[model samples]
Target: MLMHSVSGVLIILVLIATGYWLTVQGWFDEHYSKITSKLVTQIALPCYMINTITTQFTRGHLLKILPDLQFPILSMTLLFGLSYLVQWFFQIDPHHRGLFKSMFANSNTVFVGLPVNMALFGKASIPYVLVYYMANTTFFWTLGVYLIRSDGQTHPGFNLWQIVQKIFSPPLLGFMMGIVLVCLQIKLPPFVESDLHYLGNLTIPLSMFFIGMKLAQMGLRNIRPSKDMAGIFLGRFLLAPILMTILVLPLTVPNLMKAVFIIQSAMPVMTNAPVVAKLYHADSNYAAVMVTATTCFSLIMVPLLMMMVMRLV
Candidate 1:
């Protein structure tokens, strides 16, 4: 598990570096990033969610998934709330406050979490990955989106209609559809399923490419971690995982599922946090720095934590 976790993160690092090189050599540009954004947000991610769910759905898997999501979602939502509460005693600005809490709460589950579990536990890990995915996705589109949008002067606070729209995003919609199909044990047509899965395969590399482009757009100078960003680093890498381990204490799932859930919980901030930060007039450079720094550091932190988990579990 430890070795596989290390190898998994290394693979992601290589992809990120590849994208960085592409950006440096002018193979990608603003237009390329925009296109990649649209592709993942609208197409690839949705398909990916559906493919993962349908491919791995089984009676046993389905029974465990919904019940298992409770702890991670509740714990993360609380951590997000606790982060916001922490800001009250300090003099943090509105923009940085929201960015910090959002980064602390969400994880790069689809990219880092999924692959890490696969590497550590092999194909059976998909179902456990989905548990975290469903929980993280729910947190992200709701409170997570609200955090980014809070910086926009024109954006209103906590509108139900907006929440409805956010929750019904392409990826969430696809995931929901997958739940329907799987619960009913209804399979898609073989031809369509094959194509959807093929499209889904584009998500990981494309997401990394998008991140690299954002880093390029922000310039390498912006990657420096600030003191505030370091606080978020501790929150994400240390506090979040500890919280998850505590949260999972009462759940009687397999050791592997518990390990994967906590590991996924401890992942770096969501890749799209900066993208939404930019969209919603927040401190995007700050968000980008959080993403990059945590991502690079997690190469070391995640494997170490997995080793710890292996010993205890």
Candidate 2:
């Protein structure tokens, strides 16, 4: 059936409405969303990563993917370069350059990527998905931040410790601890393992629901479409994913992994792009508009792209 795309669209629309209702009712505002994002980044996401990876990280398993990590890193780097080139070629406002670069920057690996992949590809793909996230987030905090702030008189600084601190976050720390235990061949007692599973399972749904809540807070009126925004829309939601498909198809990736990869590639610009823009003095409004347009268009574009990738794979 041609329903994978349909299903994805339907699910996102439902989430959009849920977000809209929440915002209209004043249930989710910036303060609330910040708190929720904290929970996701601080606790739930890490717990899920730890629990999921620990159970799967055998020595042999790690060995299998020793080379596959490069695909995601390469994919992300390519996307970043593509974004920069597009911004330069278009002569986009110098102020908007940072956001423009970031628009196609990070993949929505957590919110949209994991659930869809899990549903379609099962639990086996989770570790690979997480590995992809490690690369994306690493680039986002370091290179991403610097690029967005290029206008400052002083040169950009890399706070290695701060970046490391982000990596060693509670959730991330837990994940690392889990990996260590697996490498050391220490098994958790059955009850403790079960508890981990219980807490970890809460992650995906909460993240998705929070994405819905964010949409509500942002409101549809804020999403009023404009032709000025089309370049970003076309570049991110269309061109970037297609570029991914072309680049990846010849790489000898598994069909299913390829499907997951392309869908991740095709996702709307990250919600965090605007956040990065604001923090770095980029054109936050342009970033927001790009985010809005790509996201709304994803209701149409992502599913179709997924379907095409699925067939090719």
lDDT of 2 by residue, 1-313 (tens): 3454345545645654665577578777766655655565566656676676777678677667657667677877887877767776677776566656666667666656666667666676676776666666556655665566563214545488855553354554676677778778788888988887887766644444455555555444666655336657766667766776776788776777667767776676665555444444555446555655666677677556656766864
| Model 1 clashes, total count | 0
Each prediction's whole-model lDDT (CA): 0.77, 0.63
Which portions of model 2 miss their true places by more than 4 Å?
90-100, 115-134, 137-175, 189-218, 226-232, 271-292
**How far off is residue 47 in model 1, in Å?**
1.1
- Candidate No. with top lDDT: 1
| Worst 10 contiguous positions by lDDT, candidate 2 | 149-158
Q: Which pairs clash (backbone N, Cα, C closer than 3 Å) in model 1?
A: none
lDDT string for model 1 (1-313, tens) is 5766766667767776788889989999877776777787689878987888888787567885678888788878788877866566454576587777778788988778877777777777787787888888877866777667676646456668876876577777888888888888988999989999999989888877767777777788877646676677767888888888887756676887778888888888888776666555676667767777888888888778777767545
TM-score for each model:
0.89, 0.73
